[model samples]
Target: MNQTAVKRLYLMQVGSMPEYQIPIVCYLVQTDDNRNILIDTGLPEFIPEEASDFVNGQDVVEQLASIGLKPDDIHMVVSTHYDIDHSGRHAAFTKAEYVVQRLHHLDAESNPRFVANRPQWDQPMDRIRLVHGDTELLPGLELIETSGHVPGHQSVLVRLPKTGATLLPIDAVPFGEDFSRNGQDDGKNPDAEAIRASTVKLLELTEREQIGLVIFGHDRAQWEGLKKLPEYFD
Candidate 1:
């Protein structure tokens, strides 16, 4: 029972791999009351040496400026997971309280799989708000616990005023193809069972809610169809 609705949802394409046809994205959710919640940080100040050619774009900070916002303007940051591309510019947002799932912060802290990405997301821990299971972050914004891509990955469900409800199944369902399928054992992620279960969970939720639109995690094909930055989904 939300009293207010999300004003706008801006998708930012921060990085892309021409070889693999992959595009990295981060989202900004603007509440009716003018609160800003950035979903994931795009990339760091410097791209990795090996991935330099494949991944290239303006970082999250630069992208925010295009929409007349700075890092400090964001009140909250919803970290879906601590993946390399997702949690890069977290420390830049000095004013935001980071939101993350409890298990993700713990497991990633102790037994982190990505050694290179550890330093980027490990900081600003003092301002973290760790929630368990599905949570209504605000009146119109909800956090969907879809942990399949990583230890405790989560997705977002935003209810916009005119557009109705939109689901951003980040990493949990990487491509648009995943939406129609009953299972998600794509072999890309290690946990096949978790992927399948989480996929089904999202499917059920989408059907029950009659979601207005669904945005995949890193689908390059789907990415082209979405409105980005200055143009938003509202």
Candidate 2:
């Protein structure tokens, strides 16, 4: 019997940026077995200028196609939360399975907090798979529940033999520095207590699991310094 080895996972930057701001971060995680798992769908190409100020309106389909894959090729999509900029074009992958926290889906459906951003998330209700707490979606990838940014935010854990371990802690911690400080000092962010707890938990998990890399939701400075896709462990 042939074993399923997780060869590599790639991150495609499908967003734009300005001179000083950080480019939004959305990624496609391609496994060795040809499973295309997309992390987040960036803001749509056509958004209002006021809203676009906070979004990166790039061509996700074209970006994926650049690497020889199509939006339809995506097998799974893991959304950390239903923020406008993060979960905008989820409909692009019409046939892909979705992984999301249970609370996130519920909040996106009927919560007043998401009233302003309902259009971005409310449309993709049909393709979702809701779960509570943590989950291992596949052989080497695990979803860690770290809800702070929103009611049901979560991150992904990718364990590979060569790359060691990687924590894709979506918006829970926008950058590595967020983990270092308690939320009391982090300023206008999520709930302070939740943020602090999530940060500490992620740090503990990384140390316990021997994780070597961390990918944040919107940290361009960090993403720019990492290895790109199509380069996997042999």
Candidate 3:
């Protein structure tokens, strides 16, 4: 059996917003085979004026540096969605292949709200690798389509050698309270049905795979209890 092993998993607190107190974070997964996979890039300098006070000084590059990594060291960058908070700093990883859903790319390009913040992700389109639906980036790293908050938002699932399974439901299940309720209709999420279905799907997967940990996207309370960078989950 060709079992893939994730050697290390680090959570980088790249940015934060005061309104929610949930630190915007990014996840780095180092596989035994020397692959460095990054999930989401935190907020960019240009955010909504209302969120101006939410900006954290550390950019994605600086956050990666804290763990002895450079932006170019990332082999792949998986965007859970194209929301400014999640995809803003994506341009930093110029050397990495930007993996995103086809629908997500289209939506970001056409949606006026996202288009206004285009400068943050104003990188060459050639760097994008658009996939339809769910796709596997590596042996144990899977991108699960859990769109709800946005038309093409997705989440990540990692099966580690030591940690078993870890589910990152990104904005699809933004907070612990939402996950606990099976899903909540945050005003921003236009499609309540999709959110409910996606959350249910994640719960099913967690139970079936016996997932060891499930990370919610913007859970302030939950984030406080997690081990941040430097101290990783092996």
Estimate the lDDT of model 1. 0.85
Residue range 185-213, candidate 2, lDDT tens digits: 55666477787788888989988987778
Minimal lDDT window, size 10, model 3: 180-189
Candidate 2 or 3, higher TM-score?
3
lDDT of 1 by residue, 1-234 (tens): 546568999999998777788898899999777889999997777777744654758878888898789888999999999877898788788889999999999989777465567776776667899999899988779998988788789999999888899999998998888775565665866888888888889998999999969999888888888788889988
lDDT of 3 by residue, 180-227 (tens): 544596565568888888888888888898898998878878888999
Please state the error at residue 194 of candidate 2 in Å: 0.6
Q: Give the CA lDDT, 0 to 100, for residue 46 in model 1.
A: 79
- TM-score ranking, best first: 1, 3, 2
| TM-scores vs. true structure, each candidate | 0.93, 0.88, 0.91
lDDT value, residue 146 of candidate 1: 81
State the weakest 10-residue window (summed lDDT) of model 2: 225-234
Off by over 4 Å in 2: 1-5, 16-20, 55-57, 112-120, 123-126, 181-184, 229-234
